[model samples]
Target: MKALVTGATGFIGSHLVEELVGQGYYVTCLVRGDSDLKWIENYPVKKILGDCLKHEILHKLTDEFDYVFHLAGLTKAANTNDFYSTNATGTENLIKNVIKYNKNVKRFVYISSLAVGGPSMDGVPLCPCSPPNPVSEYGRSKLQGEEAVIRQSDEIPVTIIRPPAVYGPRDRDFYMLFKMVKRGYLPYWGKSFYSFIYVEDLARGIANSVKTEKTIGKTYYLTDTETYSNEFLTDTIASELKCKYIKLRIPKSAIPFIANIIQKLTKTSIINSDKMTELKHTHWTCNCEDAVNDFSFKPEVTLREGIKWTANWYRLHKWL
Candidate 1:
């Protein structure tokens, strides 16, 4: 077996690469020239240096793989156009080139975001048929990317996985939560329910999608069986880290002002007014019944176990 992975240097992609290699597949990573290789430095996978939007690079990469995991995407940007250009347009470019060059590829797994499908109401897991109601520009762009993949599905075998708030070792986003817990404080804005998956479990689910016949031309939400409230998640992490924290729930009206200050201080769009809308959503759970039924995609890691493992990694790396 052979595979081509975009965004192979990222948190989820790096784990997927390791999973594929362990499964006896020869993997090739499509990464940007400046991508940090700390996660995959020891892997034996071949690296193809190029941007996904570059037609020649995509064409060349499409010629030599039996499977493609399209994970490269822009999650945060100062402008909305940047999101669409990289996530939506870049996905279209990769799929088109694959159709023209790699007809024998077994599957093209587009690793999409749960943001594209938005929140579920009242802790209900959003199913495949649920109408998309994206809250942020980043969510909208991801939806466009899903559409792009769907457009080429008739000609190329494609599967889409919408993963929710994934966390594990080597993950940077949720690392902040562990850090906050270590700092003896956790801030909450509003009550919300979220679905989460350990990164390794998510990678295993993606790898299984390739071998499962029913997954082609379908979308699945790869999440754990349970949904957790924001407060419960905070408490769980604090317990896992063996730390005590002053839990503060800021007023909803003050979040926008706080987000502005953080955005300015970090000089990053990750914490902006656009992201504030997503933070205020009440539910982010998704249904994984279809995945369980067809792909055997059962996520084995529990929240407590996952958090404990992640916290240990932080400690080992001297990050906490």
Candidate 2:
């Protein structure tokens, strides 16, 4: 089997690339000219240099592939237009080029976010059947990308995988928490609960979706079937760090004002008011029943085990 993976250098994408190579598949990585290729440097794969937003590049890159894993999208940006251009337009461009040129492509797996569904309306876990109520520009743009891909389901096999708070070794997003836990200070914002998936588990889920016939035209929420509170998460990290967990709970109302001041002065906003509001809203859990039933998806690593592995990686790399 031959496959093309976009965002091949990203946190989850890099892991997926490694898995694909290990499975003995001929993998082609679509990356920008300036992207760092250190992760997959040791792996044997074809590297195509081009930007996803460029039509000529997409036309050239979509030539011969059995599957396309559309994982390239902006996760965090200061400007909203950057999100729309990169996430929405980039996806449309890829789909258009694939339909026009790559007629033999059997599967197009899109790596979307759980944020696309926004917070749950009640205490119910977010499912594939819920209507999207995206709150941030990031979420909105991802939803737009999903719509674009779904429009091509008639001509191509498309599957969407929405993962929530993925973390594992070499993950920078959750590395901050590991650092805090190492320092014996674990801070949390709200009393809400959220779900997570190990990066390896998510990568395997994506690969399964590509190989499974029933996954086409379906959206799967790839997450653990466990919900954890912010306090519980902090404690787990602290336990893995072998430190006394010092919990610091700040008032939720003060996050916006502090975040705004930090944004104005340092031009670095860690957690904005809007993000805090989303955090306080809680119920960010997701149901993985569909993925499990269809693809035999099961998260191999427990939360504690994953955290220990992440903490060890951080220590070895001197990141903690």
* Highest-scoring model, lDDT: 1
By summed lDDT, which 10 consecutive residues of candidate 1 come out lowest? Answer: 265-274
Instruction: Please tell me which predicted candidate would have the highest TM-score against the true structure.
Output: 1
How does each model score on lDDT?
0.88, 0.84
- TM per prediction: 0.97, 0.95
Clash list (residue pairs), candidate 1? none
For candidate 1, lDDT tens digit of each residue in 229-275? 98889898888888899878798898889987887777555667778
Once superposed on the true structure, which residue ranges of model 1 sit more than 4 Å away at CA?
none
Model 2 lDDT vs. the true structure? 0.84
* Model 2 misplaced stretches (Cα beyond 4 Å): 262-274
Model 1 vs. true fold: TM: 0.97
